[model samples]
Target: MYTLHYDSPLGGILLAADEAGLTGLWFEGEKYFANILGPEQQERETPALQRTKRWLDVYFSGREPDFTPPLHPVGSPFRRAVWELLLQIPYGQTTTYGALAQQLAAKQGKTRMSAQAVGGAVGHNEISIIIPCHRVVGTSGSLTGYAGGIEKKVRLLQLEHVDMSRFFVPTKGTAI
Candidate 1:
């Protein structure tokens, strides 16, 4: 695994890649920091890393990026499915966990899928901003359960200029 560090408004972000493409990006001190790469990881700015940095630069400047870097996040089949759906979330929009579960259920031809299960998969996304796990909210429009911390999530939404009034930090649950 090859890694590089990017300085963003949020703080230092660690970017990792391999022969396939960009694999992981985690904020400093996030809950799953470097969860995908092993100790054999090396620090090198590959083309993928450079592209990811440029993408971050545009995104942090409050402009929607025109392209997405090649992403090759490592995860189970279920997590991959959830992450793929996360990527479809528009730049300044948010969706509920229950809504995502319903979509996944429809895709899988099942009657129902649990919102909690979708939340677990969303929480485990290896690529943060690029895959857009932060766009997932609770059914009640509560900002909840971001592995990178809710403060960063809020800032990311603000960066995208998402309407803050539509979402709230839950008073009695994991949002705190």
Candidate 2:
């Protein structure tokens, strides 16, 4: 894998690539990913660095990622399916994890999955903002469990012009 560091308006970002194109993106440092993967990502994530960095440049600039470049996010088949489904989500729209799981379950003839599973897939995505996982929210429109932290998730949502205030859960039993 090839790796590169990208400095965005928010912070320093890490990119990982391989023969598969792009593999991972982390706002945390190599040390953080290394802790997660049990080896240094920078040591292995050295192949798709150039292309991934370029792709990120386009995304942060507000253009949609062409996604023509190679990508290799590692996860369970179900998680991969979830991630692939996430790709179909448009640039500025949102969906609930329950809704996504329901959409997939509809094809398999039973509602076998739960929103938490979808949330797991969303949380484990190695690629960030570009994959547009920020578009997924709680059924109640609350943002939850972003690997990049709520602040960054809010920033990304705002980047797409999604009003952060609209997502805050109201006080207990407050009227609409």
Candidate 3:
């Protein structure tokens, strides 16, 4: 595995990639930072990492990136499915965990799905901004469950031009 450190307007970011593709991107000091990296990992830049840096560069510039780098996030099948759904969320838009559960249920031919289950899957997302876990919100449009912290999530949403009026930071919840 190869890794690179990126300094973003929000804070430091760690980027990781394997032979297959870009694997993980996490904010420094965020929950589960570098949790997937093994001791054998090296601080070296690869093509995948460079591409990711370029993506981040465009993203932090307050504009949507025109391209997406190769991503290879590692997780369970269920988590992978949830992450896949996350990628479909548009740059400046937001969706709720309940909505994602409903989408997943329909995809799997089920009548119902638990929003909390979907929240768990979202929380464990190995890749952060690129996968867009920050775009997921509570049923009432509450900002919550971001491993990178609620402040960062708010900044990301604002960067994407999401209307802040429709969302509020929960005072007592998993977000805290």
For model 1, the superposed segments whose C-alpha errors exceed 4 Å read none
Please list the residue runs of candidate 3 whose C-alpha ends up more than 4 Å from where it truly belongs after superposition.
none
Best by lDDT: 3
Give the CA lDDT, 0 to 100, for residue 127 in model 3.
88
Top of the candidates by TM-score = 3
| Two-way TM-score contest, 1 vs 2, winner | 1
lDDT of each: 0.91, 0.71, 0.94
Ordered list by TM-score, greatest first: 3, 1, 2
TM-scores for all candidates: the values are 0.97, 0.82, 0.98
Q: What lDDT tens digits, residue by residue, belong to model 3 across residues 85-170? A: 99999999999999999999999999999999999999999889999999999888789999999999999999999998989898
Candidate 2 per-residue lDDT over residues 48-119, each given as its tens digit: 666676777787787777664567877788888889888888877788899889977886688567878787
The lDDT ranking, best first, is 3, 1, 2
Candidate 1's displacement at residue 99, Å, is 0.6
Candidate achieving higher lDDT, 1 or 2: 1
Instruction: Report the C-alpha lDDT of model 1 over 1-176, residue by residue, as the tens digit.
Output: 89999999899999999978899999999998898788898899888898999999999999999999889989999999999999999999999999999999999999999999999999999999999999988887889989888999999999989999978877665733
**Which whole-number lDDT from 0 to 100 does residue 122 have in model 1?**
93
